[model samples]
Target: MLAVNYTTLRENMKTYMDKITDDYETVIVTRKDNKNVVMLSEEAYNNIMENIHVLGNKSNYDWLMESKAQLENGMASAHELSEAETDE
Candidate 1:
């Protein structure tokens, strides 16, 4: 990990470019106050995005977790919701 101020990044853009190699992961550019931008390689970006699926649906999450555990233990059972009647 490298912390570089925006001015330094702007001044040494070429040096920063040269520093990027296959071994390097990311280059973070920040202000003196530590506000920053993340620079990542395409392969790194793709790998990060690929693992983003771990962040799944927030709704019904607790239900899912409990049901998942139950299913794994062969104790899961389903209850069908009653259908609502519609009048014309």
Candidate 2:
């Protein structure tokens, strides 16, 4: 994540665009009136939206919470990823 003033971002829009797209970074543009905004890669935005969709559902949220509880209580198994599997 990178923070930049609105004026600075306005002056170097292309540079910031390249950073956000090529580097997959999130940019925080600060406003004078404190209305800050974020600029993220399209893939990042899509992933966030998908997560919101999943967590917004009652059943999905309940299942996720249950899974988290199980993991925290030592009821879940952790596995090490092999090199081939890690590539994905």
Candidate of highest lDDT: 2
Taking the tens digit of each residue's C-alpha lDDT, what string does model 1 give over 1-88? 6767888889997777656556564789986666678877777777787656443555556667787898999996789999999998
Quote the positional error of residue 18 for candidate 2 in Å.
1.7
What TM-score does each of the candidates earn? Answer: 0.49, 0.68
Candidate 1 global lDDT:
0.73
The parts of candidate 2 lying over 4 Å away from their true place are 69-88
Please give the CA lDDT of all the candidate structures: 0.73, 0.95
Q: Write the per-residue lDDT of candidate 2 for residues 1-88, one digit (tens) a residue.
A: 9999999999999999999999998999999789999999898899999999999999999999999999899998768987655555
- Candidate number achieving the greatest TM-score relative to the actual structure: 2
- TM-score for candidate 2, residues paired by index: 0.68
The worst-scoring run of ten residues by lDDT in candidate 2 lies at 79-88
Alpha-carbon deviation at 51 in model 1, angstroms: 1.1
Q: List CA RMSD, all candidates.
A: 10.8, 5.7
